[model samples]
Target: MQLPILAYGHDILRKQCDEIDPSYPGLDKLIDNMWETMYGANGCGLAAPQVNVPVRLFVVDSKSTHDRMDEVIREDHFVREDTGIVETFINANILDESDDAWIDEEGCLSIPALTERVKRPWSITIEYFNRQFEKQTKTFYGTTARMIQHEYDHTEGVLYLDYLKPLTRKLLHGKLEKIAKGQIKAKYPMQFVK
Candidate 1:
């Protein structure tokens, strides 16, 4: 089942998500649904908070992004040969971030119709539990790493909009207000602040 994504004005998106263990109720089902919801919305990543669940859980599939790219674009976009991974991350922690940074346009399932150019590390070393609940540590690079960072920030109560220039955010305030007022149309179901 595809869950309704919570919109920007919702309070849950601003909370620090708690880490979850395998014992968490409906763990497997939630992860599966998240993937469905994400793919249905054409999003490369989805965080639990975006679904109104404030927990250190999220799903990502950068391969979905790669498959859509032209070969020439792919060559310029992917910095790592591995390209990406499709995985469910639980209780994730960023161990280290590479000094190099890249600016990329990103959009969120929760904040529909808004895309921002955000600066993020080109690579990251992280530790997290996989869907099987096995702890794993790995370094991810390029767009894959960018997707992970975006989803990870959601668990930390951060939004890509927060990284925008102050003037840029101010200029977009009116559109943001419309989104918060539930006046925007999205391809998927969304729950907005009342």
Candidate 2:
């Protein structure tokens, strides 16, 4: 089932998520539903917090932008999944170590109807888990890496707005307030912020 996405000002989005335990009932289903919910909402990533569930679980897909898997191989680095979807990270550690820069427009599910430009590292290495509860690590650079960083931040109670410039926040403050007040409805209300 696609869960109702919580909007801005909701406390759940700001709360740090708990680690996922594989033994938990409905864990697999939750992951499936998260992806369904994410894809349905036109989002590339979705954290458990967005669904009002504070679990250290999130989904990510970043294949088109970052093709730097070769670099990690060159460094004799460890490899994980062929398809990049960091399903559940009990504790995710992200390292920013890439020079290739790119500025990208980003949107959030909580702060619906607002797309802001945020500066992010083009590449990163993330250590996390797969659906089967196995440990894994991978390096990504470009848009894919940005997606991972964005979603991981959600697990820590960080919002994209926190990273936005003051001017950007000021411009969207009124609309975001309206969104919070339900005074205006976004034509495309986001269900996943990352």
Candidate 3:
């Protein structure tokens, strides 16, 4: 089933997510729904908060991103050899982030049409549980790392727009207001705060 994505201004989007254990009911089903919702929205990543669930879970399919690598490389100089990785992260924590920062324009399924250039570390070491609740610690770099970081932020009550410069944010105030008022249109189904 494809869950309705909660739009910006939803209270849940600003709340920190709770960690779920292996015994959590319907864990597999939720993950599957998230994947369906994400792919339905044509998003590369989706977090529980986006679905109005305050849980530390997210899904990422970098295949679409991989498919766009040629254009990305031409426009942003992003160089990476690995491609097409799909993974689920639960109860994730960033152990460390590289000092090297990169600026990339990012968009969120919850925020609809808004996109912003945010600066984030190029690499990160993270500890997380897989779908089976197995613990795994790994390092990710390039586009994959960027995608993970974005989704991780959602779990911590952070949005990509928060990283924009004050002036830029101010400039986008009108659009942001429209989004908050549920006046904007998104290709996918969304639930806005009343």
Top candidate by TM-score: 1
Off by over 4 Å in 3: 71-81
Write the residue-wise lDDT of candidate 1 on 1-194 in tens digits: 99999998888898999999889999999999999999988889999999989999999999878888888877756864766689999999999999999898999988899898999998999999999999999999888999999999999999999999999999989988889889996989999778
Candidate 2 Cα outliers beyond 4 Å, as residue runs? 63-90, 99-101, 186-194
The better-scoring model by lDDT among 1 and 3 is: 1
RMSD of 3: 1.7
Q: After superposition, how far is residue 170 of candidate 3 from its true place, in Å?
A: 1.2
TM-score of each: 0.97, 0.80, 0.94
How far off is residue 2 in model 1, in Å? Answer: 0.9
Model 3 C-alpha lDDT per residue in residues 27-48, reported as the tens digit of each score: 8899999999999999999999
Candidate 2, which ten residues in sequence have the lowest lDDT sum? Answer: 74-83
Winning model by lDDT: 1
Report how far residue 23 has shifted in candidate 1, in Å.
0.6
TM-score order of candidates, top first: 1, 3, 2
RMSD of each: 0.9, 5.9, 1.7
- Which lDDT values do the candidates have, in the order given? 0.91, 0.71, 0.88
Model 1, CA-based lDDT: 0.91
Q: For residues 19-82, write the lDDT of model 2, one tens digit per residue.
A: 8667977988888888888767767788888888888888886542224456554232222433
